[model samples]
Target: MTEVFENSASFASDLDSKDELQSFRREFSIPQKNGKSVLYFTGNSLGLQPVRARKLVEEELAKWAQYGVDGHFEGGRPWFTYHEHAKKGLSVLVGARESEVVAMNNLTSNLHLMMVSFFRPTKSRFKIIMEAGAFPSDQYAVESQLKFHGLDPEQALIEISPREGEFTLRNKDILQVIEEHGNETALVLMSGIQYYTGQKFNIKAITEMAHQKGAVAGFDLAHAIGNIKMNLHDDQVDFAVWCSYKYLNSGPGGVSGVFVHERHGDNPGLPRFAGWWGHDQDSRFLMQKGFKPMPGADGWQLSNVNILGTAAHLAALNIVLDAGWQKLLDKSRNLTAYLQYLLADLGKTFNDFKVITPEKPDERGCQLSLFFYRNGREVFDFLTENGVVADWREHPLNETSERAGVIRIAPVPLYNTYQDVFQFSRLLKLALEKEHERITE
Candidate 1:
């Protein structure tokens, strides 16, 4: 049997004292409340900025100032190949070859671009399959893509949802849907980690199932890239896209990344929206009419690199790389496990408190979604007012049901500590107690 953890501040302090990555906490500038750093637990929404990000961005700004238009080739890092500096680091994060990855446009934009090449619809196989409650942007992108092909989204979009009264989708159910719609499904685009429920999907299995069904498989790793371990190439996923602003520690609206399996990278006949930057480096400046795309994922680029955004991403990737991916993932698993344990302890005191996120560590990353039976908004307000920085989502599982509100706490391994998790648990307990008293009064 496993040992039970005590719900005590001293126990949390003990855990912190033994943590190897505790020093990483000082590397970020934590938000302050009442002269103290707030208990920030929303890294899943927007990661805390790395202290080195400003220095990296300022370096690019200095290059632009010193070299003017010549910064393209003259600067130390050089604007011409700035995105390359981030490729190696991002490749390790997404588990792909450097040639297969490129830091480029934002997440939704990259998704659209990938869809241009991958979402080939025909009368026989013209449907797109996706998770029912995907982020709004993904939903909109798929709908628009269908319409662009002169297909009605209502007829061509297939959504696989959780069974009634369930908060998360079962893997078997998802696979069964793919089997049922195999013939008509043109694409299978789903999140590696479902953002709202903090559920991590089996990417390799899903990709295999999609392939078996004669459907192209891709993923939106907006919540998965930095939060979990992925092997996109080994998984045989056709393409994947992710944003850097969340767990990646890049600034808000930072440049995103894409992965095109090597199999698809060299196909000259693949359809894509082309631009000058994606032209062969040797012949790019020749100003030739016919487009010759560079090999690999870079061939999909629509414009020159976003220098400032790339700089910020480079800095953040450096931090992650320095810490080591395996080490970070190990810490992330433990940190989230500790948070879940504490939340369960709190649930013992508050009958209304429920954890909707999966109980198994392998099924989740660093986030836990807490569902309150009542006073959900009021409790969220209390946590905010008390200096606990978390996120709340009003997710309506179905049209006929009331909104299912949840408070999401992500104990990011890069900065958050065991003590932070303990503090959040304490605050949450107090908030629930207060809510209970107010109701009884």
Candidate 2:
């Protein structure tokens, strides 16, 4: 039988002592509050910065100062191939071959590029399927794609929502909808993990279903790439796009990544918006008349790599690679499970607070979304004032009958420790108590 966890400071300290990755906490510069490290639980929004990021970026700056234009080729780590240094590490993180992955443009930009090539809707199959309430960027991208193709979004876009009274969608229902609309649907685009609920979708199963239905499978993995283990190649996911600023710990507005399956990546006949950087390497500087795309995902590039951003990414990826994927995942699972246990324990004292995130381990990632019966915003404000850094999502009152909000807490394994989880639980309990006293008085 497994040992039961105790809700005590000593227990948290013991767990920290036994943690294999405990030393990694020192590698990141944690934000301070009242002369102490703030309890940060918002890696899903923006990850903490790695200490080595400054050194890596400065090296490129020095090269730029000394070599100027020659920095493209003369530097030790030439800007010409700067992105390549990070590709191997990123591919390992997303479970793709190096050639299939490229560190490039922002998330939405890559999504647009992928849709241009994959969302080729004919008159017969003009519909696009996606989750209801997907991240707004995806909604806009799909709507614009339909408009760009001279189709009406109201007629061509299909959104699959949860059953009445349910907070999350079921896999069976999603597959059924795909099967029913297979003939008319041209694309199936969804998030690997829903941002609001922190619910992890079955990517492999969904991809297989889309392929069987003759539609292309693509994912916006902004919340999934570093948070969960994915097998995009084996899952046969046609393409994927993710931003690096979240769980990957790159700086804010960092470069993003894209994955195009080998089948489509190597095909020179595939249509894409082209530029000089994407041309054949040998003839790249030949001032060539014809646009010849390089093989694999690199062929989709429009401009040269952002050297400074790539340096930050390389620094962060090195930490992830050195720690190993499996070890990080194991820690993530345990930390989340511990957080869930604490929340459930706290629920006994506060009947008004409920956890909406899925209870099953495989169904969710590290984030736990909490729904309060009343004064959700007040509680959020209380926590924020008390130095708990978390995210809050409020539903528009006009769109729904009742005003609702969810507090999202993500305890990342790379820098977040057992003590952080314990501190959050303690602070949350105090905040709820204070709020309850205010309401009753």
Candidate 3:
């Protein structure tokens, strides 16, 4: 399917013509570069803020300014249930029961909290498995969890990798590692979509495999949450954590969410690092001596929810809910497939380029990781100079063996249009051609 996007302006016209979510683009404040809106394909890094975010935040501020101490209850949409507003929408997005999901701490912190409860390792079966090239934050969080449990991360943590000359992890290989290590593994933790390679793992199969080995399964959905429809309940994942800043379209530093399967909701004895927020509301202000946990994921909370951040998250989630996840994911698949096509087409003209993201649309998300054989950094700098915004992925030192990293071009569906993808393809061509000319001289 060769879909033609002639130019950015024509792409915008085409975008305006058929974009069911075009109104949503207006909802966000698009950043300007050189008097033109940047062909932003970096929503995998930070989402553009919804214009309603300011209004939502101001509501909280108004409540605080008016009610002060009484804002906990007296204010309309009381602070007491502030997080409830975001739950149903987020549940819809991730396909989880309302009781199973909660808006809470940031992603890494939530991962640590989930690990505290779920990562129970005995001396004999104490290994934790994760992808070798997971986001650095996840790596550090897992390492901290290992140390917190009085175990060595280097020893207890099992990192999976692809074979030689491979760019993405094969599903069978990942399952094989899980099966091989399931006997000794305490928990199986992996990213829903790899941050660097943008590979969307086989979550359902992986979750079942982890359970078959008597291990709990979890996901760091920082890159997957809104990039794709995550059927957490259908997948039967034990627990999951994700940040709102990326594909969720929440502004920078937005609050995160956690999912605990309904099966684990009633497990009151599950060990956790609790705070007053996790206590029952009836006894919460009573200054109870003991920590009797609330039921479900809410019981995992470690602090009072961030009302302002949650408000920002709600504005974004509202748009997502209105658009419907099925439609968004469909756009994502088509948008990314078109992007891959454009990249492949560009590669036909530019010999030194290779797309590091998987060819199969189902195997990857919206981001395409690109490997430039020469002048990669200069090319990246040039793209930025010409109003294209993407990111660079630093390779795992162990995997790279002293090679440079690749540039990641993530064209998020919520805000990016076909024009954005086409323009990026054009700029990539220009960047490479300019680099070639420079090198020849």
Local accuracy by lDDT, each model: 0.90, 0.90, 0.85
Candidate 1, residue 189: the lDDT equals: 94
Q: What's the ranking of the predictions by lDDT, best on top?
A: 1, 2, 3
Question: Better model by TM-score, 1 or 3?
Answer: 1
Residue 274 CA displacement from its true place in model 1, Å: 0.4
Instruction: Kindly list the per-residue Cα lDDT of model 1 for residues 143-254, writing each as its tens digit.
Output: 9999999999989999998988788999999999999998999999999999989999989999999999999999999999899999998999999999999999998999
Candidate 2 residue spans exceeding 4 A from truth? 1-3, 396-403
lDDT of 3 by residue, 1-441 (tens): 225543445754675468777666788888999799998878989998888989999999998999897898976678898888888888987889998999998898899889888998898899999999788899899898889889998789999988887878889999999999889999999999888878889899999999999999999989888887778998899999999999887778889999999888768888999899888878898996999888988899878888889889999999888877888888777778777877777777788767878888878888888876555778889999999888875555445433356888887777787777887888888888898899899
In model 3, what are the clashing residue pairs, if there are any? none
lDDT of 2 at 436: 83
Residue 414 in model 1: lDDT: 94
Q: What TM-score would every model get versus the actual structure? A: 0.98, 0.98, 0.95
Residue 270 lDDT, candidate 2, scale 0-100 = 97
Q: Over the stretch 1-441, how does candidate 2's per-residue lDDT look in tens digits?
A: 114788888988888889999888887999999998888999999999999999999999999999999999997799887878988888998899999999998999999999989999998998999999899999999999999999999999989988887778999998998998989999999999999888899999889999998999999999998899999999999999999999999989999999999999999999999988888888898896999999999999989989998899999999998888888898999888888889999998898678878998899888899976567888889889889999888853224524368899999999999899999999899998997899789
